[model samples]
Target: MSSPPEQHSGQGKTSDRASSGKMAPNATNAVSFFNSTAFDTRVNALINEWHVPGLSLTLVHQQELHSKAFGFATLEPPRNCTPDTLFDIASASKSTTAGAVALLVDDEENYPHVQWDTTMSKLLPDDFVMAGDSYTNNVTVEDVLSHRSGLPSHDDFYFSKRSSHPDDPRTVTRNLRNLPISVPIRTKEQYNNSLYTVASYLVEKLSNKSFEEFLHERIWKPLGMSSTNLQPDKTREVGLGDRMSKPYIWKEESRRFQVLEYEQTPEAQGAGSVWTSSKDYALWVKAIMNKEAPINDEIYKGLTRPRIFSNPEDDDLDPFCSWQGYAAGLESYFYRGHQIIQHDGLISGFSSVHFFFPEFKVGGVFLGNSENAGTVGSGILVKEIIDEILEIPESDRTDWNARQHKQNDEYEESKKESQEKLRKELSANDDGLAEPLKLPLDVYVGEYWNIGYKEMVVQIKDERLYIDASDRTMAFALDLEHISNNTYFLGTIYDMLADGEEVDKIKVEFRFDANNRPVRMGIDQEASLDGQLILYDRVEESSGQGQQKVVVR
Candidate 1:
């Protein structure tokens, strides 16, 4: 990679504040940022504000390394963080397996002619009831490795006491097996830690070696990552445990960070639970960037290539993060034509961030023992580092991390304005409840269809109003609210007002007929039009109880 927009050659390792003035990172070639002060100030402010334990940052600029340390490793006897402080890398471990797969595939030593057709059933016991057929069975090892397994995140599965069972992983594995997969293989990208958990077994079946052994032989030893290890729960008692940083969550009432740990997940063994330091991870990043050295760029290219695109959601607050979309193992986005491969780690309280800019040949890793350390988005952090090193515009380096927030803010403003307009409009209307025109709950029973556009029905059985349409059905909440004399809202509500600056009113309205019968209709003021639910009522019920024919009126 070229040195920024300018040409600065002598700009690496020796470029630090405490160390030197002569070999400072050349400012001539790139926008050499002195953000260590600003960044440190911001970090300290965050630490004091959030009461985070420890955070370690490793920034590599043209082979120059800068590591900054802060805070205690734990709450009790709070120890100051050292440059060599070891933090649990959390799910950041996935990228390791991803890299291993890339290496294996590149080597083609025993790589199979895989697709989205391979079966876990063959690998495991027959009694295990995982969904899908030969199509899903044929799902390639690549499919699982890339997290395109078409299964919802198996997180809830871990809440059960069975999930925490020691020695036996089947408690967790059983939940994954029983999950009914909705999307078929190659249909949609779904993140599944369980599939990656099974990846260990997959590798073992093919290579006749444990996942640990394979990684050790193929990656860890080769990269000289002596510090990195897949910490097993069995050896934890014998003092052979990876030096771990337990996670923490903010307790508002107590106003202190509480230790957060998963009950049975340490035994999960396969998908997550790995530990190392920024210094060690720098070597891993360096190896990845300089792919030709050991694993070769072929493996690097396959692993880093954009297989699928995704927009990951941010959980700045709250205990867990919402679904962040998948981009193979690594997430990618163009920062002004410069592509970045990144991944984040979340194991309750502990958080880790890693991002690599392939174009600039630069990467950064941040391990935070604090839960809320993710407040500063990774994209901006990585870009600022890249921009400072390579002298690029910060705007070009910043990410779309703030996009959703901006959009949601705009939507909220619009909604507020719309609400004000609605308040004015409602006041303008002189109609009050002259008569409620309400009907008996049971009278609104039996599929009431709007006749043409679609079908929605209120099926009353055992005194419950169920909205039925074909295979889909939703029961109306018992506490129905009467908005107007003739209008009522049920279940979920949405206002379909026109573009701003008008008497904002519900474009889609539901109101009963003169007969006082509850009807499914959408109105934009003039007259009620049949809704989608009306399609199911085109025919009349002749002789069956609660079974009516559709007759689009």
Candidate 2:
């Protein structure tokens, strides 16, 4: 269903298409490589190998934009993707969020008090409270934006059921007090989406406008990225719905890609939710690289300043780089001796990678409709392009495809071994006697409450136990299978989000009161904390009428 590859080139003031018709030798070589037949063939091969339905690739060289698209945007309807086709750039939106905040920080006339060092307690004292007093009082806006706020990624807290104020950013920021802090304040980089939500809330408070509105007035409009928006629905509202790429996830069992629903919630707006096209995203990156408006020297410095090491123990030792670090919404690293500033975004079925070489004034943006497209597809192809531009010797070039394939195989094998070990453990019994439950299955059917996760309901359907968060749609529901005595495995609850082997690892244990009544439930939600379970108490009814003598821990 895919059409032939399409290419678009835009002329800039300093472009090779200028009146002089002159280009740097390196730029000329790069342009030739991008337009060559071999490059198109290579792109097609990568897309086919990775099973990516569609891909939009845009490059900025010599201040001009070169964009290309390949494959179908949607398989069933069969729409070929174009340079203007929009895809959810996921966490890549974080850079924009940081840029928006930087604009506010730089605008002394409008926001005199707002700065990178401004504490959240000072900004939103009532809403932004961390677990510890030190964290609650001293954590700054920079700390949160750079992901050094000491908060663990309690992603399920927002993604679970519809809480009291599910769509409200303030509610999300206020709930941070209930969650646990995994590390010490400013000790290490702990990527947390909730912190960005708090940052969005700060933007709202400072600007007296919604985060989306602020972004439009300041960042998007100035960069001429008209197609870029905060929420997915806006894409439809702007009459660009036809060009929006349908999200897809690779199903290993079926050896096919399955379509995934759009994430409609706005609570995590500042974290990872931006819809954009190759053309529009390239402009945004170009603006950043060219030191255009809204990206002044101070703003760019704040955006690219390395704050914390993302992975101190990353021993990959790839010849291309020396070190990597997190810088606000962007990540910075040495790629072939040139400082590369970039960010990768992956949410559900969409993936994107956008990076710029500040030294070379060259950049690349890749938007794809499959889950691992950014990591496997663009992540590999972009490096190959870089090698070509740098004129790296063929003998010295690293086989990134082989390296990635080997890593994927290793991960799959490890997961298979882990699943096998779990199955064996679950099937094994030290004693000959059966480990039957003392209480009936009905005793576990009840509502459980936790401050962090809100409410979870246990129900019996078709003679089998099932668990789901209250007010959540069926998409968040999970079937509960008894493992032993009082513990049950929440089947595949996070398999799609995390490792598939986690299906067997996520076990819920029911606790009993002195009278043998189930009173609470415990689940290992925070994988960062080894063997630590998040406890939820069972909700008891005041009246005896229609009350079941059941308890859920």
Candidate 3:
């Protein structure tokens, strides 16, 4: 992995600033430090050592923004990642969504009187019903943003859902009450994307605009984030689509990065789906650093003010971050006695981190196109950059790189072992029943309904039994491989999960009536945190002639 030529966004202006010799003292120091050969060596070494395809980074100190790009956007084509190469920023999109909601709350005309403590019951529609204690109904907007709404990170509901399914934010909010609460409301903090979708919906309801539209109007367009957007379709439309970094995951067997198909979920946009480049993201950081106008001061303060302790027990254990707490959408922590605000974003193949120290007026954003890049690479680079900015003494660059390589090596080894075990188990049990098909394949093809989830339609498409859980928010057309008896394996989803990935696997077991006609479908979905098998009853017609046929014994 040779070091690719770095591209700067505003080189002409930056040169002028440098020549003018009028830069703020802190800005001058930051520019010298980040551009120093030592910083470049560490960053390039990390990229090469981790097999990262591409990475885009931006640094801001004392209001001066510096953008840099490294490696290939596509390994095969060998397109270098530029300052404007877009990468999905994942969970870093949270702050923008939260900021959108805050902006709406700040609007006098729309929200005459609405605060973070405002009850969900009052803000949301009458139909929304949260399970658990009476306290569940009293959850506030701030509580949702801070991950204290008694909900765990039920990420699968978003990650594994059908792409064709209606990803309306309102629908996400409606399903919240159906899931069990992880803890008593306001008692503990649990980070999840579901509530962010709910909060984004709140923004939509108040502003009478889509979350993306609100951000574009208030933040993106205003801040000059020309290459930043919530939708890939829009990115393509602007001709920046081709510049987007191809996502990749490290394959243990191959000992190389394997490219993954570009996947976009607008449904989870609120939680983690924003595409941006280093150059574009710098403008966002500039907005935070400047806190210029109407949107800045109020929204920035809300986004950074600590609302709940995220890791109270580990405050002393981790030397990297201390006094950890969850703010609106950002994590507020002290790094080496400097108040740092940050968030990390990890989707399928891309990982991103956006961190800033308000007190020091320094910030950095990193985007990488590899799975390992998101898991550990970004953190490593951040530490290196921070050390330089803080001027730490006798920086052990060699030791740092060595430890990072060891960590990644261990991860790959563990992943390989996990995949091998899953493969063997799946193969061994694939024919466990050794029984013939009990009924016609058509008997199992019908629309099954689950109240907790929704409709799962099993249909024969192109002469193959396919389950379309589009209504359940799963975009994949699950091909059912007949394993044994009435059991079927969802091959497509299962394959990805076998690789130690996050794809949800559904093992479908068709329950039959006395005459061997299917009456109910029992699906073991990976999304269920408690490992409960969800049962969906086959829908019967009014004429008494339907997929569910009653046969009395």
**lDDT leader:** 2
Q: Once all C-alphas are superposed, what RMSD does model 1 give against the true structure?
A: 13.2
Model 2 lDDT at residue 151: 87
lDDT tens digits, residue span 1-553, model 3: 2223342222212211212234544435566766766656666666766667777777876556677666768777667776678998878888888878777667768686678788877788553567654745688889989998877775445433334455567777877776666567777778888788888888878778888888889889988788898867778887877888888776655566667766556666688778898767777766776685535677777878888888776523334557678998888877678777888887667888887767667777778887656544445766655666567775534345656666668767876665444334344364333344455668777777765566667888776577754333233446665556465443345234213343434455667787777778766554323545567788754455565543221
- What digit string (tens of lDDT, one per residue) describes model 1 on residues 308-359? 4343443342111223335445766664445667788765567787777776
Prediction 1 TM-score vs. true? 0.61
The lDDT per prediction is 0.51, 0.75, 0.68
The candidates, ranked best first by lDDT, are 2, 3, 1
| Candidate 3 ranges beyond 4 A from true positions | 1-29, 132-136, 158-165, 313-317, 375-377, 395-449, 455-553
Better of 1 and 3 by lDDT: 3
Q: How many pairs of residues collide in model 2? A: 4
How much does each candidate deviate from the true structure in C-alpha RMSD? 13.2, 4.3, 5.7
C-alpha TM-score for every candidate:
0.61, 0.89, 0.78
Error of 1 at 178 (Å): 2.8
Give the distance in Å from residue 167's predicted Cα in candidate 1 to where it truly belongs. 8.4
